[model samples]
Target: MYLGLDLGTSGLKAVLIDDDQQLLGEAMSALTVQRPHSGWSEQNPADWLVAAEEVMAALGVAHDLGAVQGIGLSGQMHGATLLDAAGDVLRPCMLWNDTRSHAEAAAMDADPKWRAISGNIVFPGFTAPKVEWVREHEPEIWSRIDKVLLPKDYLRYWLTGEAVSEMSDAAGTSWLDTGERDWSDALLAASGLSHEAMPRLVEGSHVSGHLRDDLAKRWGLKKGVIIAGGAGDNAAAAVGMGVVTPGQAFLSLGTSGVLFAASGAYQPDAPSAVHTFCHALPDTWHQMGVILACTDALNWYAQLVHSDAVTLTQGLGPLQAPSETLFLPYLGGERTPYNDAAARGAFLGLGHATNSSAGARAVLEGVSYAFADCHDALSSTGTQIGSLVAVGGGSKSAYWLELLATVLDMPIHVPEAGDFGGAFGAARLAQMAVTGGGASLATPPRTERTIAPRTDLQAAFAEGHARYKRSYHALKEAL
Candidate 1:
């Protein structure tokens, strides 16, 4: 048996699988994000540990964890978790969605070396800027920092008592030489850091360390079970969905929206705000266009109307033409194409005729248009996405998927229902770590059905999308 632990923004999940890669059992524990100040998002590292232990205990209650031979971890990328030499957390981790470091990010982005070396824009949520933010605002905490680890690496340290990170996660830190797949001394120096303050690097599929004896005994696992260097969430999702080959793509509609495509080469289009990061596997890379909000916007509106996303989306009828009402799903700024941390969300074209349903539909369309922008950004990089497999909480809504299909003018595949997410992908990595297998083991799941673009609504959506694009530029100054 093998174990995969995914420490997500909202929860920590544990999945158990056998040598054949079939999931035997799984458990999850919830976590919460604390936004003490505007534009900032954080979580206690202790909370992550608590959630991890909760899931493991729950899984142990029902499964034979003693047979577990390997463990893998996956988590949200770009979170800055600081540690002292004694291995104590210095403060709450600054998460990927936090935009508190916009000024720092802008300053770093101005330095061409950052883009040249990292192959990414210095977005506020990236780890480097977050570290810089602490340096400028919380110098006392910064002074004692001995190491900076991404979210998952912190969890890995708890499990194995080691500070380790992999290519996929490190690529987001703006301190990595993406093409070379190693830390860049100049970039680290620019951030007032060095190699000594960073975790040791490894490939996602390789074994990084072994589980600690005390924890292993408590969790009913072998003391020295190998732990794989797992991936960032999206890269892990790609592994779970078998999107390792060049041109294979997946669209994620979680808290954020992402259009991710695997690439065989290190193609950087930093100016376009398309993220070029190493894939979970060695000698591979992926490019992604990101929008800061997706289901988050939906949930925002749901809260306004005192309804849930499922009910709100379910209340709507058949997919209709683009609503006269429009929304910009920039609830927490944006990433791809614009990289505007100060940009705010707005609901345009609202009139007396606009009701709750129309507002909800507008929210959905706005998100679709945001994705259309992402698609265009990727297209500009000459990255062709033949089709996209839909994943995340928002993908559960058929109406939203149909509308997204119409807006993108491309087919969207929905995989058979199961836990083909970060945790499952991490399990696959664990399997690879133990068995010495590679891409061949990462097979795509069976497609349950496909949602094809509505040819009938093609021209209408084109016009709607054009208007949507125009609204952003026209309202940029005011919004």
Candidate 2:
């Protein structure tokens, strides 16, 4: 048996899989994000360790803990977990969604050397910008910083007593020369950090350390259980969904929306605000276009009107092709195609006739349009993605999946595994680390069904997509 742990923004998830790749059991522990300031997002690293330990205990109750051979980790990316010299957390981790570092990111982007060295722009959500923000705004905390760890690595440290990071997660930090798959001194210096402050880098599948005896005993597992250098949540999900080969991709509609495309070599589109990063596997790379919000946009709107997102959107069934109501799903600003952190969501073309159902439908269509824009940015890298395997919370909604399919004009497939997104992928990575190869597990993902594009909605959606693109610029100018 092997275990995959996902330290997500909202929770911690654990999945247990046997040597044959069958999932034995899975569990999750909820976490809360702290928003002391308007645009700042923070989480307690201690809370992550507690949640991780708790979930592993729960999962061990059903699975043969004695048989657990290895562990792999996946997590929300770009979070900066500052630690002191004695390895104590200095402050709450600045998460990937935090937009507090917009000024820092813009200042870094102004330097031509950054894009050339990192193969990507340093966005507000990335670790390097967050570091600069801390240096500038919280100098006291900066002075105590001895190490910079991404969220998953912090959890990994508790499990294995080693501070190490994998390539895929490190790629998002802006301190890495993504094309070279290693830390860039020039980039680190730009962020006012150094190589000594970063964790040692390893390939995602490589063994970074062994489970400490105390931790193993507490979890009812044997000592010497290897801990593999794991991946960022999206990269692990790609591995889980078998989107590894070039031209393969997946669209994730979780808290944020991600359009991920696999690339055989380094292919970057930093100028377009597309993320170019190392893949979970060695000698591989990926290009990602991100939307700061996806289903979360629906959740936000639903809450505004005192309804749940699923009931509000899914209840409307299949919305008509391009209703006049168009929304910009930038409630938390956008990443791909536009790196604007100040962008806000807006409902354009709404009139007296606009009701709750129309509002819900508009939200879904707006997100799909955002995905379409992201697709254009990713495709510009010359990777022709024929179809996308859909995952994340939105995959459960047939209406939303259809909307996405029609908007992308490509088939969207939902796997049989249901909502187990990053956790399942982490487990697959664990299996690979223990047994050399685990490709059989994800080759097909037990696809539940495929949603093909609605040719009938083609023209209407094309017009809506055009308007969706225009809405952002219009709103930006207005704001």
How much lDDT does each candidate structure score? 0.92, 0.87
Worst window of 10 by summed lDDT in candidate 1: 434-443
Clashes of 2: 0
Score candidate 2 by TM-score against the native. Answer: 0.97
Q: Estimate each model's TM-score.
A: 0.98, 0.97
Stretches off by above 4 angstroms in model 2 are: 418-420, 437-442
Q: What is the lDDT of candidate 2?
A: 0.87
185 Cα displacement, candidate 2 (Å): 1.3
* Pairs of residues clashing in candidate 1: none
Error of 2 at 440 (Å): 4.7
Clashes of each: 0, 0
Candidate 2 residue-wise lDDT, 307-378, digit = tens = 998788657866577878888887766798888888878889989999998989998898999899888987
Q: What lDDT tens digits, residue by residue, belong to model 1 across residues 400-446?
A: 99999999989999999787788888888988887786425458888
Judging by lDDT against the true structure, name the best candidate: 1
